[model samples]
Target: MLVNAIWDFDGTLYDSYPGMMKALAALVTANGGQIEPKTLYRQVKETSIKQFLTGFGQQVGRSVADLEADYHQRARAYLQDIHPYPEALAVLKAIKAQGGHNLLLTHRDRSAWEILAHDQADTLFLGGVDADLKLPRKPAPDAIQYLLRRFQLNPAVTAMIGDRSLDVDAGINADVKTIYFNVDGLNAAPQADYQVDHLIEIPPLFRK
Candidate 1:
């Protein structure tokens, strides 16, 4: 059966890690604490900025709110660095050619799409719902359900493609197939229906 796929934007579609790391490092230093770039990157991936900074502030002597504001300010320019992963655009094109329906579901603000929409012009994005929308982010299934209802999709034939465990959980919660795109088995989520190392491997899954 033909399927509709919902993709996660951050680590899945675009490699925003480098820019995120840069922004986070600057944020840490600006708040009078010193943290290694790699360490900051890992922390950001594992926890949200508010929680991460709340913990960090306790270690140093600062308020989480101040640190968060600084991080957001420093991260403005970094958003422009967001770019598609290698061959991701080509893979998306192939999915479109196969008559697969595609949509984007992310925790990022809607404005992030204006900067991140490159090469995705051909896909049917229902626009970003954003974290501020108060809709539960991935792993809660709210965003997935919204997409399904909006697009009139069948959960059984639909798929969620992403690089994190949250993506798999979201798909499972929404009763859809989950495709894990972690090439190195970095994220070992139990809900995944298929595991692939590269974007090019996606097209074969639709084959009869």
Candidate 2:
């Protein structure tokens, strides 16, 4: 049977941490605050910008909205450098060649999608959900359900590939298979149907 996979944009398909870390450092410094690089990187990975900024603001006595606005303004230029992970495009091509369908399910906004579309013009993405859609984000199952209904995909044959537990939760909620892209085996979550350290490792799992 052909497989349908929903890929997470940030840590799974793209290596967005470098740019995000740079942006966070600049934003915090501009606000007369300081944050360790490692801590900021982890925070960005595990928490939403709004949640991180809300806590950061409470620490430095600034309004969350104001800080988020400033960070987003400063982060625009940083996003320009965002790039896909090595072999990500190749993996996508391999999957498609094997009669698989792919969709992007991310918490990113349209700006992020524009960046990705520019970087990889030929990638086969059925459609994507952005923050502007106002659908609940990852771990909420709303976006996955939308995709399943839109594509008429079988829940058992569809998969969600992501690097976080939220991704697994989303897949479970949507009644789809889940693949954990644990490059370092850092997050040992047992809920994942499969765990892989590299993008290319995915193809074999779908072989009939």
Candidate 3:
């Protein structure tokens, strides 16, 4: 079976959570606040840093704008830590070798292009739609819907893979098959067509 894909960049294809959480913890501490990496990370999983920052500002005694600026600076500083997860590239290449369209949909900003390009994985994608496109964020189907039409893909043969429930929800909203990359096994029962504990477990779910 031929397959087309939409992948989430940050946590699914990459192990960016540790670095990102550490950055958030540092930023919070530098501003005279106290938040552990694990605590903030979980909050972010349910919501975005921007959204989380609204209330986080009050707790940390800073303005939302200031907090956002701090986050942007820290994110750039931590870019080096955002390497591709082991075995992720192999799966993507295997699918591409089989004549699939692998499109990346990430909420990560345009700054990610430099990192991806540096890693030489940017060209592996057919195309990418990210924050630069200014689409509504996940749990909203706008971005996926656009990709489906742009590629003229059949929803049945396409899959959206990501590490969070929002990713699964977006794929569900778009009416495509969803694969949740629950590596930690925390998502005991994600509302996805399939659940994978590793990136290498992905290709078999669709390529067959």
Candidate 4:
């Protein structure tokens, strides 16, 4: 039986892209750099913030630190405004009801997504580890490994779910079941143990 869940905060649970896009756009524009909406969206969906900012910095002739500072400053104010998918709370509650322990790991700052978690459904998460924790980010397996070891969870009973390929890679790296929340129905899917189109679809997989 599935006993634990490691969730990805940004795209998997919360619809944070719109706010993130605005933050990136405002930061680049304020820095006198122009980034097309399509370019920003594709990169954000594909890579880490640091990677994107570094590439963007090179493109715009600014320090990554400068772009990053502006982005984070702008994002903090908009963080609380992010909302989960309509099915997110229902799925979280369902997992808890089935005796699964839910944990969250994200690249977002601890101060940012935590507000939305409290505002939406705080009770569903057993714990959350974020960038503030100083743990290595996902696709490295450090954070998830820490959670599994600390909690004494069996790897076989754990599943990681996220919308990005990085999320899948993290789970695979950690040797747990991985679920790709393919909301976009992309023709080229990530390598995951399972794939679901929506949060509501996840519960049935665990039930089996």
Q: What is candidate 3's lDDT per residue for 134-189, written digit by digit as tens?
A: 99989899999999888788998988888888889999999998988887667833
Candidate 3 Cα errors over 4 Å, as ranges: 60-66
How close to the true structure is residue 123 of candidate 3, measured as C-alpha lDDT? 80
State how far residue 17 of model 3 sits from its true place (Å).
1.6
Where is model 1 poorest over a 10-residue stretch in terms of lDDT?
119-128
lDDT of each: 0.74, 0.80, 0.82, 0.82
Q: What TM-score would you give candidate 2 relative to the actual structure?
A: 0.88
Ranking by lDDT: 3, 4, 2, 1
Candidate 3, residue 148: the lDDT equals: 89
lDDT digits (tens) for residues 47-105 of candidate 2: 55667888889988999878877877776777867788898888887788788887888
Model 1 lDDT per residue over 1-208, tens place: 5367688877777888777678778777766779877667566554455667889889878898787777777777787788888877776666667777768887777645675555545344544456567787568888889888878888888888888777788889988999988744456665689888888888777633
Q: Single out the weakest 10-residue window by summed lDDT for candidate 4.
A: 183-192
Where does candidate 2 have its weakest 10-residue lDDT segment?
41-50
Model 1 lDDT on a 0 to 1 scale: 0.74
lDDT of 4 by residue, 112-182 (tens): 45565576676678886788888887788898898898888789989988988888898899999998998
Error of 4 at 12 (Å): 1.1
Better of 1 and 2 by lDDT: 2
